[model samples]
Target: MPFRPPPGRAAPDPRLDPYRERAGALFDQGEQIGVVYLRIDTFWRQTGGHLWWRRWSEPSEQVQGYIEFNGGGFDDFYQDAGTMVAEIGDWGHGRFPYRGEALQVRWLDDEESRQVRVSTFGLDDLQA
Candidate 1:
């Protein structure tokens, strides 16, 4: 299932106008966009008798083009996040315009640090 923000957590920050504007312009151009937010947390896990760990790193300065939207499946966003992280070697942050609504990419630290969370919120739904 696609991730959903906790109740009362869906509002976009007012300071994200630049991202919103960028995504809005793409929506105006008749393009479909999907938000991709990547988070790398510091943690360790044991799987198949092997230990794996991930260390947090600073977000990259480079921003890639909008991820193409194909039905907006949960796996699609997860794959996009993985690809972006592979390219930048860090967390990914950016806005994506979807179906005429501007959705910002944001992150949450999960308890196990095992799942990637991707969500969307409209630009018009920003708080004052």
Candidate 2:
């Protein structure tokens, strides 16, 4: 008889839910294109975790690749010195602390009427 392998455990979802009960921005867009950044930050803050981002540059801001925001490292995912919005803004035009073009926060919802995503991007992602 052949030996059988044990079943694998289910992995937890990393994306945050930003629908219905939890939906709001913590900071204003200010004078720059801070809408997307601020929104992502707010989501992580409320959810108590981090989300993946596709870093983009200004002028011709476009998706380059995935940014590694390791969720478990920073005490406060959005407030660390290296990744803070204030510090990012200081870098001047087109310079962001993140690696990719833009930060993408993804989530899922079983509600038939609701969509499973916070941002336009990362809808197809399977992990953080």
> Who wins the TM-score comparison?
1
Q: Candidate 1: list runs displaced more than 4 Å.
A: 1-30, 47-71, 76-86, 89-128
Model 2 lDDT vs. the true structure? Answer: 0.26
lDDT, each prediction: 0.30, 0.26
The best candidate by lDDT is 1
Tens digits of lDDT, candidate 1, 44-90: 21222223333323231222233434466432222222234333321
Query: By how many angstroms RMSD does model 1 differ from the true structure?
Result: 13.7
How many clashes (backbone atoms < 3 Å, residues ≥3 apart in a chain or on different chains) does model 1 have?
0
Please, what are the lDDT tens digits per residue for candidate 2 over residues 15-96? 2222221211112222322222122211111222224423221121111122222332211123322234353343333333
Off by over 4 Å in 2: 1-37, 40-76, 80-88, 99-128
| TM-scores vs. true structure, each candidate | 0.24, 0.18
Model 1's lDDT to the true fold? 0.30
